[model samples]
Target: MSISTVAKKLPTTAIAATVIVLGIGAVAPVAQATVLTFDDIAPISYFNEIPNGYGGFNWNNFNYINGSSPKVRRTGEDNGRVSGDYVAFNGFGNPALVSDSVFDFNSAYLSATWNNGLSVTVEGLKNGATLYSKTVIVDTTQPTLVNFDYFGVDELKFTSFGGVEPNYLGGTGTQFALDNFTFNEKATSIPEPTLLPALFAVGTLSIGSVLRRKQLNQS
Candidate 1:
């Protein structure tokens, strides 16, 4: 073909190639969600604490009461047994006390940004007896994502207390906590469209170079 004809075709070819690459990238698919499982429990004491007179344990002073009924008194052995301190929940109290305490699992303050959904399940056995067992659904739509803090207390009134025995206080055998928390997200359905711009830029440069060389030859 003549030089003029070649120059005319160069730009079209470059633009076509750029468009094709952009199309390919835009049609690419995204990724899938992930599941999380916990074998060991992590403490969130920053948000949770045991209150005095609520249970035999006082998280404020890190002490445990070691007496029966109204005679309950603080003991050194009761310290640091429970994970999170009080105030982790909107209203911190022993769930076993009057079956009124609702532990907030979002206290971990873990960020779940861009997550499609979050599922949390808490299971604990105190004193060889089941203290709390429940799964909480968390909404992750907010731009400012925050996780709940989990807390537990030793109540003298609950069967989970293991016969009001102080020896079983903080041992893993008697007190247990777990969080089966999972984060999920929708897979990227397509590759980013950014590639289109890049491809176009490269193609434009290629065509410009070809035209410059053609002009030089004609001169």
Candidate 2:
């Protein structure tokens, strides 16, 4: 109801109701960010298998897994990295990583060994169509953290640039890696069980004021 209408009715009750509703909002639970460290996934380095049911099995939580040749370099490994190990794309005449299972990934950090045309693209797909896409060129010798923090998508596609050959030790393809690869976790619109203690205290005070005002009007 409008302010004038509420004021025309029982002012104390309406104001108290508003206060209680706002108190609930102030005490709502918040969503947290989920980071994919790719650290404890063992010493395995190759994400270079076909998707599940074809010749692979979800790549251990990473699904829709299809690409030229992708590999994961674990932390503490002797792989050339800024610090820890990371995942890289091997140029098997083609260097691309595609997936639709990483939902709600806002931004990612990539590490490259200065390979030419090192590009990464992320997109949102719906019903086998491209909803949106963002591409980045990674030409660096260190671990670079790139942000697509503006849009949230259902599908995430990471592709290393082409025209380069695979030489994991010193050449072109598999020398690229993604380290500290992370994403955020978000909560649904569902509300929690109850409000915090402070919100309850304020709500009680608001109700008390309404009762006091009612008594004064009755007198």
Which candidate number would show the highest lDDT if scored against the true structure? 2
lDDT of each: 0.31, 0.45
Per-residue lDDT of candidate 1, residues 101-131 (tens digit): 3222222222111112223333443344556
Query: What is the Cα-based lDDT of residue 195 in candidate 2?
Result: 35
Candidate 2, residues 82-178, lDDT tens digits: the string is 3344343334424444344334555566644335456656555544567677776654344567766533444444444543432443455523455
Question: Candidate 1, which segments miss by more than 4 Å at Cα?
Answer: 1-193
Count of clashing residue pairs in every prediction: 23, 4
lDDT of 2: 0.45
Question: Over 4 Å off in model 2, which ranges?
Answer: 1-14, 21-28, 44-83, 88-102, 150-152, 163-170, 191-219
The whole-model C-alpha lDDT of candidate 1 against the native structure comes to: 0.31
The top-ranked prediction according to TM-score is: 2
Q: Model 2: how large is the Cα RMSD against the reference? A: 8.1
Candidate 2, residue 55: lDDT: 16
